[model samples]
Target: MKEKIKIGMIGLGGRGMGLLRLVILNMSDVEVVALCDRYEDRQTKAADKVEEKQGSRPFVTIDYQEVLSIDEIDAVIISTSWADHIDIAIASMEAGKYVATEVGGAYSVQECWRLVEAYERTKIPCMILENCCYGRDELMVLNMVKQGLFGEIVHCAGGYQHDLRDEIAYGYENRHYRLDNYINRNCENYPTHEIGPIARILDINRGNRMVSLVSMASKAKGMKEYIKNEKSHDSELAKLDFMQGDIVTTIIKCAHGETITITLDTTLPRYYSRGFTVRGTKGMYTEENQSVYIDGSHDHYQSWNKNWGNAEEFREKYEHPIWSKFLEEGVQGGHGGADWLVLADFFESVKKGTQTPLDVYDMASWMCISTLSEDSIAMGGHPIAIPDFTNGKWITRQ
Candidate 1:
């Protein structure tokens, strides 16, 4: 392991800069060696931030390939647009650098497979930086599930239910990538936020795999309505029609006979919530209510509302060990400290040459949800088989 793990940060967009400012630069044992973005302004801004923090300007480039070419960079943190994640991750792996890609759905199952193949060919670790996987509530629920509290987990449900209307409508003005996606594609565009933790609970791509999924999309009215009501009559966005549905619901059946339901509810009016929920024979956890209900412990039919916010009571006993240490060390960074934890995990794995918690197979399977949902919705909610990226290795993988 190097004395200090060196990093190349690609895609200096809002997300990229936020991760750099909040997490990577705050770490004592990591160094930012290079930064890349298509826009020179973004690259320059990121370089300036690095210089202010580390007292040295990082090598900046408009082309991501330049970041990958740096032989001394131990790993690359890819926070690029959704469409660019797979390509850059593959390139980073091929260049013999560890990869940590931001959360986004995949464009195609073929590309997802290609990502897996790249990791296999190079033997370089590739991790999806799905911070939600390290979420406090998520880890607590995962620990409960592992300890047999959620016995024989039968069903899990979650959603990316955020109102992204303004973000999508102003994408051109803000230089964001979502507007183009809304204009051209309609599927569950973002799935990993909720699904990442659920997959860990169910052991997807480990002990089980998602076999098939059926998706149905509602009418695409959110963005258009937002533009008409909020934007100027002559705004260019008013001339555009969004193809992405206001709400996309997907039902996935796992090979272990467990079922998972994920919804993409962006492009609508709603407060943020992942709507993480887990159900098992013995108990259940619902994020909306911030509650846990054990069959025998709580009154099932009556006093359901009384049990709301009860998950907090179990925190001391059931909190995951990772979060326990995080609390002791003081939680830091964005998204309720999940961003710091996930980045720390990735860097630690890079330094130790160890397998990341979220490996290439996990990334491929979780990301393929978007492309598969697109196919399913195109076929009028027909079920599509999710490719087993683990190539049947999931049957015995632990």
Candidate 2:
């Protein structure tokens, strides 16, 4: 822990580059030791970014294996495609390095169990870096729930409603052709962002585990066609799948009897939306206007008390010294500066030999869809089992 955590970057794509920039700019506790990407331009550009910020460059390579086998790296960040998550995480964990993966845990049940086993056997820290939990509105929602403002949160709804049709089509035109379709196909396919904060609020896997989930999906929408077939038709992805417009709605029952309704929809073309309409026995919370209705007294309280609970304004009034220290001097990059905090926490936790912000079990619970979604889809929307991370050892492991 005395030495800076030697880190490696596996993908230098948009999200990958975002994380890299954050890590290089904000973290003194970690040093990026390697950079990798399929494209030669991305690799060179990212390495230059690191060198620009830190006055030193990391070992740059096109081969992922070179990154995995590098002796100087202590941890790796997998920010690549959804399909490669399981393999990359498994390989990194087996190599005895802590892995902080972007999202979507394993794609199948066996892979989920394999990840759990790998971490358990190695005793190494592996986590999903879901940045939504770090958002200000989400944090306020968690604080309110913890304070019992939403007494017995009965039902909550969360999902990603961003319109990626434009970005998907024109984004890596000259480089990869099939990228957008691969990303756009699944529903709530990347649920960690939408589900993470809500799970923390509900104490998922901490107090209640996601017991079962049922899902249903809508037909394909042509984001690729919007780009490939329309304006950007002359672009490289002229024949991409672009994805069918889909809305995969999932209902998750937590062990403690609370139910969370999760939905995944992209390609339908919408204004960007990711907020919950939370209902509880005593009160309810709405993201529509950032208001909280109470059980007993007071007019409807708007979390917007500071900056309208707008993440921007929250920072102005957010006075916690520890968090303030992070917000002040640190450089801002991704997701309104939350990404920087994620890296800082990981490095800090490694220094203390404690768990990162979201532990492996917490990650598994939020990301269970990597296995559960397809099963529910295949079974015609039947309930599917979620694995217990405690491994039936809550009574024993404790």
Candidate 3:
């Protein structure tokens, strides 16, 4: 077994830096040997932080290829822009480095295929860092589903329903990538956060898979209204026409007769929520209310108002083994300790030289939702066929 996992940290943006500070730096068994970003200042800042923590500065470079060229690096953590993720991941895999890419949707189906192709060619494991999949509530629900609490799940719904008006409006000032996407494209631009956990619950790419989907986007008005109302934002942003809609709803049909609905609702005003929900023949779990309702266990009609937040009551019995262990070990890291859990899972797989829990196929299928939704929305909400990136292997992936 490897004594230490040498890592190359790519994309020194807010997300990248946060993961570095909150998760990677804290892992005693991991060493960041290299850092890369387009911007020099970001690279310098990250180097300084790593030096402060580890008493040694990482090799900093503007070109990500330089980081890939390092012989000692065993894996890479890609937290770059949405457009750059697949290319960087493909390159990393080709370099024989295990890959853990931060979550984002794909720009095109072809690029998604290239990710799968690269993994197949290199035989290097690539994992999507979908922190939400390891979320405590999500895992508890997943365990409940697996244990037959929510028997025969028929439908699942989730959404990225956080208001990002300020972030989108000031992206240029912050040097963030989301502003350009909002101006040029309209689709379910960010779907993985909500879809990841839901897909796992539905066993997508294992026993079931998303076969087709149709998406509809509401009119783009949130950014314009926010820019117009907020005088602090760049005045030029008010005049620019934004293509991204305030709300994008996508319905995905699975091969197993289950349907999944995911909504992209970042621009609108709302409290943060994935709005994760599961419905089955026996019971249901709803994140909005933090409640789980099981048939024959609770009053079906009149007692729901009293059952709000009752999922906590079942935690001792239904908590996922992972979370049960996590609690015992003490939760740490961002997103309610999900960040730590996901990174740990990836590193464990790397150490063991085993397949990732969420492999390239999962990344391809989930990320393609954005591109496929774009096509569906462009064609007046016509359903588009989802590509089987697994090449018929999903039938017996278990």
Candidate 4:
């Protein structure tokens, strides 16, 4: 029998609690041995869930360092707020534990470098828990690209297009972190969700690297307008100033002759989507419409008939091996079963002592987008070079 990989969980907010619940439900190979959060209430809640699911309460504490100090924990899942990710991940790695951290862009390029250096110094595996890489549709597109359907990729466009006015404006209700971030930061704060999959498809930090990027932001009017119209005209948020733009668009150029456009549209009023769009010499795929178009696959005039081929058909044919296995057995948790897979991969990598699929270099490169974009935006959309956290090794780092 495979040995159980003892685990510690930090930060018991919604995202953290959601992942802890996923591990309890789906990951029998993992043992939730420790639970930590800054709040006693969250710690109690997580401890209760662990006991209810596993029939035993974990070692609970309000301090994350206590969880890290435990000797039995083989790995830790850091689901802290955006500003705290790098610090927690580096600490976990330095404590001789593998780490799986939640998705969010880094606050500064220096912090990203610190994360990279921590992994380098410790030789500990660290994965950014980019659950979107396990999304069924996203994986199917990746498989098709691997199979040469989207030949010689030219460009891709994606975004966090969710309408998050209420969530950001009401951050105080649940002690959520977005309110202050939106009020102060002027970058794509949550970029890893869309960029993670795109980076894999683009083979960033493997064969290609992001060369430079430019960013622009619309005026910060959405939250104030939303508060006045939705909450109250005289609400305190309506009188406060916000730095985040209603929509921030960034364009990235890759070393291997590819360009990516990332649009951050969360603060606005729009239907939720990642807007996964891939264009190549031979074909194109768009997640918003759930359709794909290949050159010469359809009649030239038929393309104008609004009946593009459905993505479901492609999913049936080319579901990723991971999703295929889950479909045959079962799938659980949020993000269309992605959360469970992300945790499963983390646990499995820990058990096997193998390099995580979303390794440290990918973590640094993907997370640094926010800081780099911030610089670009502040410089009036001037280009900013993305650091190669792989240390000149991406050219041969397969």
Go through the candidates in order and give the clash count of each.
0, 8, 0, 0
Off by over 4 Å in 3: none
List of clashing residue pairs for candidate 3: none
**Against the true structure, whose lDDT is highest?**
3
The residue-by-residue lDDT of candidate 2 on 1-398, one tens digit each, is 55577888887787788787655455667778898888889999998988887789889988778888987787888888766776778788888777888876346667777778888888888878887777656766666666676688888888887776555555565443234544554544767877787787777766467778887777655554465456664544565453333677888888778888877666666777786777887877677566666566434554445433333433344333444565567646578766876766777766677777687777666666755876777677888888787776433321
Any residue pairs clashing in model 4, and if so which?
none
Model 1, 1-398: lDDT tens digits are 75589999999899999999999999999999999998989988899989999999999888889988988999999998999999999999999999999999999999999999998899999999999999999999999999999789999999999998888877888899999999999999999997899999999988888999999999999888888999856467788888899999999999989999999998888898999999999989999999998888887679678778989999999999999999999999999999999999999898888999899999999999999999999999999999989888998998
Residues 157-261, candidate 4: write the lDDT tens digits: 899999988898889887999999999999988888889899989999889999899999999989988888887854677789899998999999999989999
lDDT of 1: 0.92
Tell me each candidate's TM-score. 0.98, 0.85, 0.99, 0.97
Candidate 4 deviant stretches above 4 angstroms: 303-305
lDDT of each: 0.92, 0.70, 0.93, 0.88
Query: In model 4, what lDDT does residue 255 have?
Result: 96
Arranged by lDDT with the best first, the candidates are 3, 1, 4, 2
Q: Model 1 segments beyond 4 Å from truth?
A: none
By TM-score, is 2 or 3 better?
A: 3
Cα deviation in Å at residue 59, candidate 3? 0.5
Superior by lDDT: candidate 2 or candidate 3 = 3
